[model samples]
Target: MHDLLFTVPGDEFPFTASVVVHVDGPRHVVRRTAGGDVHEVECTADDVDRVVDEALEALLAPIQVCRACGTPSASPDFTAVFERMHYICFHFEFEHGDADRDQACGLAGCPAG
Candidate 1:
């Protein structure tokens, strides 16, 4: 069994929450705790990649503007990097800057926070 920690932006709140994904063979479980509330989902891991993708999409579904400049785009610039050491950096961008793209964007009032 393996586990990974991910930060997911809240939908109704302007804060980010930590999600723990537990993978055990063909079974995958996602858990989140916030504001004294705990949410979890258990499903058959038919496709691990697809499940992760869908979970990430649902986590950031409430974000409508760019994390950096608050620019609205139908298809915003989003990136996620997973390293061999189990480090994950996920964020959104509206414009390129001199900063590293593999780092998370800690923008206030943004989902990437």
Candidate 2:
């Protein structure tokens, strides 16, 4: 399970931005904070993939979604993976749900995550 938290300024409308994404196994809870308003989204899946590569890709998607909304972001630097701790970055890749075989980054020397 993973939970990602982000704080958006009290502006920027017409663009639905991603604020916080809470993951518990296959279920997802996406919460939004913008314009002094708060919204919650819930996604439920049957099970969470545990493969090393899939787990890594699953870890990066929310930040990618966030960066698409014009929020300030840092380069997609590699960060340590702590237990249940979240990563915040600007990198994105479409996994097709198969991180091991999908080479989305396309960069020769870059890591999958």
Candidate 3:
């Protein structure tokens, strides 16, 4: 297993997570300081790529963009999850929020709602 540390922006600040990737396929270990260890299901290569992309976004320290107007959120973490729509993109406020969502681009500043 190759352990890699990825830094991401938290609600208040930046944080780092340690990801131990198996040389083989599927299983991996992910741990964050605030949230402790996170258990992930068997993930595909696409999932890994997505996570890496998110980390890169955090590196830029981007203000979360509104799912509606493409506006960079002035107060991203404070934006309410108004009318949970779908995965337009970015700022994963909730992990399971995308479980039953559509790709509609209209929910005000609900960045991850």
Specify the highest-TM-score model's number: 1
- Model 1: which residue pairs collide? none
For candidate 1, report its TM-score: 0.41
Candidate 2: worst-modelled 10 consecutive residues by lDDT: 82-91
lDDT of each: 0.53, 0.44, 0.44
Per-residue C-alpha lDDT of model 1 across residues 27-73, encoded as one tens digit per residue: 88887655466677887767556666566655554554344454433
Reference-based TM-score, model 2: 0.30
lDDT of 2 by residue, 21-79 (tens): 67876677666654466666565543222232233334344443343344433435323
lDDT of 1 at 19: 62
By TM-score, the better pick of 1 and 3 is 1
List TM-score per model, in order: 0.41, 0.30, 0.30
What C-alpha lDDT does candidate 2 achieve relative to the native structure? 0.44
Better of 1 and 2 by lDDT: 1
Q: Which candidate comes out best when scored by lDDT?
A: 1
Better of 1 and 2 by TM-score: 1
lDDT of 1 at 66: 41
The 10-residue segment of model 3 with minimum total lDDT is 82-91
At residue 62, give the lDDT of candidate 1.
Answer: 53
**Candidate 3 structure quality by residue, lDDT tens digits, 1-113:** 56666543354434434333443455543333324656443456657666554444434334555554555555544334522223333433443345444442345654434
Candidate 1 global lDDT = 0.53
